[model samples]
Target: MQLSSTTSGKAGSNPMGEGAPIVYVVDDDISVREALEALIRESGWQPRVFGSAQEFLSHSRTATPSCLVLDVSLPDLNGLDLQQQLASTRNDMPIIFITGYGDVPMTVRAMKAGAIEFLTKPFGDEALLDTIRDAIQRSTTALGQEAELQLLQKRYASLSTREREVMALVVTGLMNKQVGGKLGISEITVKAHRGQVMRKMGATSLADLVNIAAKLGSSCGN
Candidate 1:
């Protein structure tokens, strides 16, 4: 189930590119959804409310700065189940679970699954708002990092196979002659390939290139 009002509305769209934050509410109770929507809107955020976990899943989400205000118990899929499902995807939206029947074990499980908060019902409004603000900040930072990593991946992918080998040995503190010996190539050819790697990666210095190589290697399981 989904609230008809929210289903037809946009939540995270910032048409002007001004970086607006979105709050997604998934709860079985209509009153809870409306209350969260009112609070989020009053705080200058865009809120989209859903009456069940499955309804929220059906909605398309973006890589924008956003967080989920989820109820632990839903009519369709439960909050924890939805979290597990999202774990298999690339979704990085911060989650804050609200439940009237919260327990220590449930809180631990949710936190272990990367939920920002697990608040019991009848919680203070100020507390929830503070957590939401923090969650948004984290989401923004996470999205920025994701974008940076993607750009680095693209840059790394532009390198030729020889250039990649050159980068690997160069970052290991190997001299050009040593790299050439390892690859059974001339020292002059090694220098040329090193220069190409630096140029393609937009690295200004050997140290910078080494750092970039380290980042790509760690991410690529090298």
Candidate 2:
């Protein structure tokens, strides 16, 4: 199987040997599954092939960077239906659809549902591999953002209620005096809570604290 020039250059760049990104293939056809497995492995990704959507769904998903190469027609649930099932649970797992009998509406629906690429077989090996690479890159980015958000949430959870109150106020450009007035506390107490919020949230400056609050979606209560 010939890889795209882009795939060739990137195939050897993966530094995570045993923990390489996974490319899942869910197709009823044995031949297509085997072919994709070889190409995916050659391109330096772990390939997990399933004969049906149910089999794929049964597999335990890890938090590794990964994407799915799904055939539109499956023995059980169709690819689009499977995509729907995964939408809420696995937003980080990008999907690339492949089928020999693709249609305009099918393509539109798949793309609308956030599929990375929809290829009708016999698509070129290069195209499939290239799309898989792009999907994996997208998954990597999404997973990173998710992990960051989770960590941020954990840090936010660690704050005392007073510190959270101070953060909500401080990030909204409130002075310690104003925050204290709003919360019915002394300015010195507000300053102490603000310092704790900054330390707990890992914010070096007020601007940094503001950004963190925005990400946390904290409503600065009046």
Model 1 off-target regions past 4 Å? 1-18, 218-222
Q: What's the TM for model 1?
A: 0.88
**Residue-level lDDT tens digits of model 2 in 1-222:** 333322222212233365899888898977777677777877888878888999898888888899999999999999999999999999999999999898899999999999989988888888888888898999999999888888889898888888888888888888999999999999999999988888988999999988877776743332
Question: Which ten residues in a row are the worst by lDDT in model 2?
Answer: 4-13
Per-candidate RMSD, Å = 4.0, 5.0
At residue 99, candidate 1 shows an lDDT of 94
* Ten contiguous residues with the weakest lDDT in model 1: 1-10
Model 2 gets an lDDT of 0.84
In the predicted model 1, the residue pairs found to clash are: none
Per-prediction TM-score, please? 0.88, 0.90
Question: For each candidate, what is the lDDT?
Answer: 0.81, 0.84
